[model samples]
Target: MTLTRPETAATPPETDAAPPPRPEYPRPDRDRSERWVNLNGRWDFEADGHEGPITVPFAWESEASGVHRTWLERGVYRRTVTAPADWAGSRVVLSFGAVHHRAVVRVDGALVGEHVGGYESFEFDVTEALTPGVSAELEVSVTAPADKRAIPHGKQRSIPRDDYDGVSFTPTSGIWQTVWLEARGRTYARSVALRGDSLTGIDIAVDLAGDAPEGAEVTATVLGTGETAALTADGSGHATGRIELAEPLLWSPERPHLYRVEVRTGDDRVVAATGLRHFETRGEELHLNGERIYLRGVLDQGYWPDTGLTAPDAASLLRELELARGLGYNLVRKHLKFEEPLWLHEADRTGMLVWAEPAAPSRFSPEAAAAFEAQLPAMVERDGNHPSIVIWGLYNEEWGLDWDIPGSAARAEAAVHAYERLRELDDTRPIVENSGWSHVRTDLVDWHYYEPKLAVWKDFVARLAAGERDDFPVRLAPDFVVDKSLYGSAEVPRSGIPIVNSEYGEGFTSLERAWHLRWETQELRRHDRYAGYVYTEFADVEHEAAGLLDTWRRPKDWGGARPADVNADTVLVLDLVPLAAGADIEPPTGPLALDVHVSHHGRDSVSGAVHAAWLPAGTPVGVPVPKPEVSSGPVTAEPFRLSSAATITVPPPSGPARLLLWLADESGRVLARSFLDAAEVEPPNRRGARPGEFEDAPAPGHAWQPIAFDDS
Candidate 1:
């Protein structure tokens, strides 16, 4: 074992109380107790017929749940509680942390348990419905129905589905999340799991609960690292062990570390949190602990104009993972929502990298494939001990497979049996089977083009990154025929694995969605056979305004462009091809050559120089632009081009302008930038504006305004 730094817990002085509405711990990796009890705040609600108090975790149609009303269906809730008077028989339980599609519960009214997915987590025991210290009556009863075909309900919707009409939203119904009461004891420790392993260590299992006696023991430890392991409990309650650790430290997205274990047995214990790494796929890229890596990812859609899927607190889920790692995103596909294990424990304390999925069911039944295969083993047994989940996804663009996975051979064998039942429940990440297209089996060959032109999305992403197109015409449902080799039974071979485009972006204007997110992230880092590209969102939810923030999370005015300057991992790829209606270089009747390169996924090799600035055609996309008007002088960095090719030139910009192009490094520091625009033709003040409007004026009634690009 070799773990360090895991102590920090001191701040607790100020007190006028009143700050516990979602006050964290909705299960921070199984946290087992200080005898829990949050149960959020104020309850006794009702629905559809309307009634009093409601905020116990938002979702009464949001607006922080003061009952924002829209379409309720069924609700209830009640309250009462009590059980804290010191020593009582134990077990109490209760839990919840998620309840959207259906619940039930009831303590002093009888019926004890019920759960039906909406996104995992559920508990009950309720210690024989309370008594030892009096007071009971809990109740619950939710519903959330407007008919979502057997229920998984991701993008919510109540009645819209002319193929996800305007990409559905609103309808989180009933208690959205958080509601506690824990306690434990009678025999405890029902589930622990762990895993780790950066070359041999941490494996533990546990699972006991209520009568676990035969050999009992269990153990685990590791916390500050005295390293412990031991196991035993087997006459059915199960146990298992491991711990090794020689060197350990490896979790990445650039150092995320984490260890803190704990476990115990008999009287129970809990506390988890892991990390060692090893995300796979070497043949076509994406490695992780073994290194390679490159998945900028974004698509979050967790939603919250005032807490719809709960989370307007707990530091806004670590400020939306520090604003998607300050916009350079190192993964976060959480799209079809299962989110909130406190946002995967803040993406395992901010090293961020998660793909996760759950919530599909729209139509296609056997009770919607058993409510979407009962939420994939309760979301891999409640987030299979997060190492910031490296991807599990399962069915997206095919919704409930009604979108027809290539004319339905039983919906492509139910998407390859939900990717072999989540690779037999946790084969440690990588699943994606049916993410953005018709891929029958998958370990990532991802796709989801949006194609808002840019010369036909860079010639369909350079012919699907040179393996010469592996399907893409996308219709979604009219007769459905996407054909992954005619419905995919298993054959994603584009040189075997790692393709990913996950979802591209379109525009409506934030400078044309920051110029199609800087030319589709510089044509997916000018293709080194891709391996990543998630864009299409990260905010703007009630009616998808194609966010880069905006739905109160703010940041949106890339007309000064700065999504970490084209999501840096070292970038610059400029062959300047513009025309999805903007012109990146045309008025050039003189010097204007171009041809630069340098994708560089960094691990070394990066000399850097390539400058070039111009800025004028309304300069504003992230401001700051002055110096250089040409330089390529010392460029080196090769991973996906740039073994030669620098060219650069400049001059001809008498009217419409804005060129920029950086690279720097070798102490000058820039490391990637690109913005073109020029022009002599189509600039009647840069047309198309609408969503939040603003090429020159109009920000008050439609409200978004941050214009500039005007050569008029």
Candidate 2:
């Protein structure tokens, strides 16, 4: 079935809601109290000496900022503030959560520090520039080059590529995150890393900066669990220890239990939340806390209509998580961009699993590689403590790397280097070197195939399941092949790595969209070798209409079964295949012959019967579609149980028609349902026959062909 021009409901009006208050200590990993000041409201932005007001943290291109412009050259932010009387004895540290491309900070007309990377946080010590009871003038000059290749900007196009369309977004420039002033003692926690292991419990490491007093010791306490560990700092001021919990409350999608931690040394204390769980792949299946897991995930591009890349507030991020959970997705693939700490903190709090990726660099070069690698350690270190981030996506579709070269030695070598480098930074999580359509050395075998043909897709998956290779266009790269031998070699080589379809199916009508989702998910459920799958996206962005929700975050109903129902953790799937392709009926149409494919995932066995019925167009049948008189015989121990439904009839409709099939339990509770659009054929007039009525040449034959999706 093909649906064109899918109808969409009206979206809510855009609001000029006031920006919410930001937390003083934006970084949860290393938080501080009275010493921090939020400088996020409005700043004096001078562009070419013309002064104007621009929101500090919000991107200038975003509507949230009064100055709704794209790229600004030679912009200087000037501000002045007096130090609080209480902070007389402490040193002042100026922090910029993030600035685009490059930024240079000056205090009292003297250069203090400069930062090149746009995605990572940077700080400058302004103690010497500040005088007691005096006002300090702060100025930051930012430059964002129009050349996209100069920086590692993900999904943002300076000059649009031929393939770049509405699927992506516009570029963001200068200070998209929070900027603030922090006052601290001479000695403080510079950074911290936390990891949870089932065997060893939880490990915490603290890196102290400044002249730490002698005999200082770092003490960590697990808030509610009464678990504590203390380690004395060495001369260099670094401390490490491990805390063992009494009873492990393993974190999962169902119950996201977190252990709050407090670490203190000297006058400074750092607080963080972590979950005790392990995510690993055993053979072809993913195990969470030693139990096999089927990841039901959605592709989330962290963009807001009004705020651009930055979410307006913490509540908005929470709402997004709530929506995903309500929709039956246990995981979210943070496509390309690394999201804000607030969102990541919310994910940890709400128990949403995330696959975090670095922002993709536009092109390949030695300079680009250096810039990209320079930012990975800081990114991983800051985000490593969050348990929601289970996997790290080092590259995406070979964005900034030369993976298309023949033999692809450079790409393969780069992939291995990145994988190994990230492993050294944080060995707690697996790494996807290049998320889709390529594999040199990766923890998972992932591919992006938008195969729309159902039968062809099914045959390809079947061949993979049978441990046979097929020439079905499985390439090492999206545009070319790197290693034909390594493609689908996981199953053949019997590699313990798991497999995921990272992306698939974009832009379909409501009915077609719903049907396609069910079919693709069922295919994965039937194939136990596959670990899990992530749909193309959660919401539509710009011209990409394939999202389950519109750009405004409004939900859509595609067909009989809600998208959530089809994606639930434990549910039955009924695949109906008609025996005969063409059936001609006039006034009295009889039961149609169909081959039923019954399967269940997230459960050992399914005790259900199949029901076949017909409903007219626009009819709202109860879900899991209403059960009919034709009951399924029995379910088998096999993954997909096939049976035949013979001679179930349906009455003709006034307009267009539909045929519905439902899987119901023994108690007549509907588990799942599927339907097909029906169009009555006008019987050939024997009295005056048309020229090609019986030729069967004009109309193409209809067959059940499955669709494919991608993981990222």
- Top model by lDDT, which number? 1
Which tens-of-lDDT digit does each residue in 1-712 have in candidate 1? Answer: 0111112111122233765466667777778657877776777787767898877777788766677886777889898888786638767777887888788988878998888877788787777777646888898988878777557887777564525644677788888888888787778876787878444688878777675556788788888877898888788878887889867777776678888888777566777887878798877788877778888888887877656666666666668888888988888888888887877877887789999888788777666876797788878778888898988888887778777777778878887887898899888778887887678788787877665557667776887788765665553433342433312554555576788887777677666887788887888888787788888788777766778887667787776677876887887777767764356557676888888888888777888678787777767544344677778778787654434668888887777787777777667777777667777555456357686444234222111221222123
Candidate models: Cα lDDT each: 0.74, 0.66
Q: After superposition, how far is residue 469 of candidate 1 from its true place, in Å?
A: 46
Tens digits of per-residue lDDT, candidate 2, 1-712, equal 0111223221112234744234435766455754677777667787764578777677777766666776565578878866676777776788887888799998889999999887888788677787547887888898887677746887766663412222457777877888887777667667777788563478888777766644577889888767899887777777888988777787766677777788777676667777777998788778778777777888888776656777665556557888887777888898877787777887887888898987867667767767777789878877888888888888776667754422456655666678788888987787887776557668887766554545555666666666675223433322332332225223233456788776655325644555566666766666667777888778766555667776667777765546676676544443442211122122234455555555444535555655666666546645545546465565433332322322333444454555666666677766665555555555546667687454322111011111232322
Backbone clashes in candidate 1 total: 9
* lDDT of residue 75 for candidate 1: 88
Using all chains and alpha carbons, the TM-scores for the candidates as numbered come to 0.39, 0.84
Which candidate number has the best TM-score?
A: 2
Q: Total clashing residue pairs per candidate?
A: 9, 15
